[model samples]
Target: MRILQIHNFYKQAGGEDTVFEQEAQLLRAHGHTVEQLTFSNNDVTSTKAKLQAALGVVYNPQSAGIISQSIKRFKPDVVHVHNFFPLVSPGVFWVCRKYKVPVVMTLHNYRLLCPSAVLYYDGRVQLENVQQTFPIKPILQGVYRGSKIETASVVLATGVHKLLGTWREKVSKFIALTPGAADLFQNSSLRLRPEQLSIKPNFTADPGLGAATREAYFLYLGRLTEEKGIRTLLKAHSIKPFPLKIIGTGPLQALVEEYAAKNPLVEYLGFRPREEAMEQLKRARALIFPSEWLETFGMTAVEAFATGTPVIASNIGGGAYIVQHQQNGLHFSPADAQELASQVGLLEQLPDLAKKLGQHARQSYEQHYTPEANYARLLQIYGQAIGATEKPASATVAAEAGL
Candidate 1:
């Protein structure tokens, strides 16, 4: 199969970028032809560039022409889009429609349904945008980077796309990373149909399982942001129940540093290289994920599973799906510090249970998250999109001949 992959990178590299690269490599490794067209938010640095992007965020003629030319030249069987927020806009989907090509977009976040791209605001799941035709709430609140003007760009982009039926018709298929994410979109006021969406979880390369017994400390790996439940995590650690090592930096770095200083049991290692982080995952007893928002998919939890390290995540959103309670891992209430601390205490008391859960987690990875399984599912979805695109062409040709 010939695949044309499109993506617009975020200012900071995240799991969506990782999944895009991995899926492209997986296709190429399987002897499929893969071509990539990419843009970066980092390129919008200057004032003039930012203004131009804001103007084009709703629809860019230049980007459409570029994508159209690529479509005519490559003639791909499928065009897989990763992220197309501010720079690459929804215009690319219209381009695919113009060229008569199937377009498969991965829903890595809640960008289609919310301007914030994460359905979170004010330290909680913000669902007001779900029923609003115009996402003026996020804009008024300056949800996107605390700039109402910047937020307005995304609001206009998504709102215009809805009016134009871009997501409803232009795109051939949508790949939601988890069932919970798909359900959110389904239950929303968006016009996305049931047949148009498919659920596919993200996968990680297997980091061989760790020893049966792990080190003393637990692990926390993610950006130290408010929505990630960083404050709640700090509050839990104040009790000093278990040794916790934090690995990542964000706007809440000062608070993390301060907590680590005051609490001897807490240690903040800052941002470590991917290899170093994976090594730590292999050594840790359990990965602590205290996120409050409904994460599209928890990549760190899957990484923990790959390392045979059970995850103790909040029972909400994608984390709840990833970490099955009492099976592969445990779950606490969304952002209750007391519940989180208690789960830590439970793991401390039942060391054998933790070890068994770690084993189950590794088993889950082998069954669901391995490269082989993901590649097979990806091919199936591509086939579905291609077939769906071809049928209409076939019907049109038949009508032209009056046969």
Candidate 2:
């Protein structure tokens, strides 16, 4: 079977990119023909380029044409679109629709429904534009640098897309990372055909880095953004008994550095290579994912699972999906330093419990998230989508011949 995968990569590599590459590899390894139609937002270095991308934050005609041309060339059985935000708009889906192809779009984040993508506005998760109690407009007042144009663009695009039936018309299947995410849209006015929405989480790569070993210090990976609960983690480290080490870089790097300066317990490693990052996860006592928003899936947490490392993740939205609250790993309140500190303390006090959790986390990784397991799942989904489309083609041809 031939499959065409479409994606518009963000400036920095994220989980969506990982998913796209992994899925393509799985398909090719399984002997299916896969072609990627990728567009990048990274090359926009100049002011003019940035302006163009900002304009494309709403829509891009050039990207739409590129996607249409690719569909015409590839003639794939199924077009699995992973990401199409800012650069390649939802209009790309229409390219596949024009050629009468099945489109399976994986909503890796809440980009369609929420402006900020993670549904995080200001310092907290904003369910809507206004503060429920105070009537403060966190949505209008942009988080960083305060660009009203950029903020309004995101907010408007999300609103306009939902209002115009963009997701419903373009997506043949809406692949969600978890059941909770699938239900989030279902409970809302957002409607896809009942069976079209399915929960399919991200798969782990065969880390040439191998399994992680237990260490004395807990590791905090991923972007050091505010919504990631970085401040909370730092505050927790300042209070907690055990040592904490942070990796990665983001806007909150300065704030994190400030915390590191005052506190001896917290160590800042800055941004490291993937190999080095994996090694850090391997040696760490546990991986801490204190994200305050509905992360579609915790890629770093799963990456830790691959290394047999237990994760202490926030108990909210998609973060809850990865760490099962003490069975596989532990969960802490999203932005509560005290709660996070207590969880960290529990692990420090109970080595046996930590070991047990780590072992189960690895088992979970092996059973469901491993490359082999994921490949099998990928093949099944591919077969289903391909077979469903092929049936109609054959039937139509047969009827035309009056056979």
| Highest-scoring model, TM-score | 1
What count of clashes does model 2 give? 2
TM-score of each: 0.96, 0.88
User: Scored by CA lDDT, what does every candidate get?
Assistant: 0.87, 0.76
| Residue 327 CA displacement from its true place in model 2, Å | 1.4
Q: What tens digits encode model 2's per-residue C-alpha lDDT throughout 234-273? A: 8887676568888989989999888888878778999898
Question: Where in model 2 is the C-alpha error above 4 Å?
Answer: 45-59, 129-139, 143-145, 208-213, 386-403
RMSD of each: 4.3, 5.6
lDDT of 1 at 287: 96
In candidate 1, position 88 carries an lDDT of 84
Q: For candidate 2, list the clashing residue pairs, or say none.
A: 212-282, 213-282
